[model samples]
Target: MRSNIDGKRLVDRIRKYYKADDFQVSDDGLSVGKDFYGLNKIKRVEVRQLGWRENAVNIVSLALVLSAATWAFVPQFGLIALALTFVIGFSCWRKYELRAEFIGTDETGDHWVAIARGCTKEEYSVFKEVERTMRNQV
Candidate 1:
């Protein structure tokens, strides 16, 4: 998951992975370049909603963390439990609020997937906009 991604930085990364000839985003979000995955073709592009499977895992992990904090007090376990709790909590919050997935299929039948999960709202918005623009073109 990526967070606090600068729009300019994100664009730079995209350009780095995909050459100017390989991938291009139009000023109007109308025309788009292919050459993704060496399959210079675009079949369909859409913003996909990630299901509850991941969320469920986070929820369960959080629950287990709480239980550990309450019931387990081993000297070594305390620090580990606290750390795990913090991680799980952040993960749940991110999944619930910021992250979104965009998937595009190339003509050669390969899926190009990008996930945007940011800690800050501004970062999340930037990535979301990029995904939306790419989806609109296709």
Candidate 2:
């Protein structure tokens, strides 16, 4: 696992990478970035899959693996035992963390940034500065 300080730095870097022009302030008093171009700028947009549901499927597969293990002691089930463990248990492990993100890679290439909440001059200065930096990098 990454250390807390490293995680924070990484988050800050991402924030800098995706600078935005305007936004609505969030409850946490942090200037969360908003994609002003709205839906038009977004392509290949998708929602996150339910991780809990995938986990449930994996658990069932694992249960089947255990059952196959026990039944292996009986007879022919032994050959299939190892196979089931590999197929079912592996599938369970493979589908653990499934998430979706708005990834845009068009003429501008892949870039994602957010404008900080608040239209104030100070906030815009900071937000614009970050956006400028990101755009320059592109």
Q: What TM-score does candidate 1 get on C-alpha atoms?
A: 0.32
Worst window of 10 by summed lDDT in candidate 2: 93-102
Supply candidate 2's per-residue lDDT for 122: 52
Cα RMSD of predicted structure 2: 15.1
Residue 113 local lDDT, model 1? 42
| Residue lDDT tens for model 1, 1-138 | 245567657655643332223334564332224322211344344433444675567666786767576556675666666667766565444431322232334465445443333334455454456556565655
For candidate 2, the TM-score is 0.22
Q: Score residue 112 of candidate 2 by CA lDDT.
A: 36
How many backbone clashes does every candidate have? 1, 2
TM-score for each prediction? Answer: 0.32, 0.22
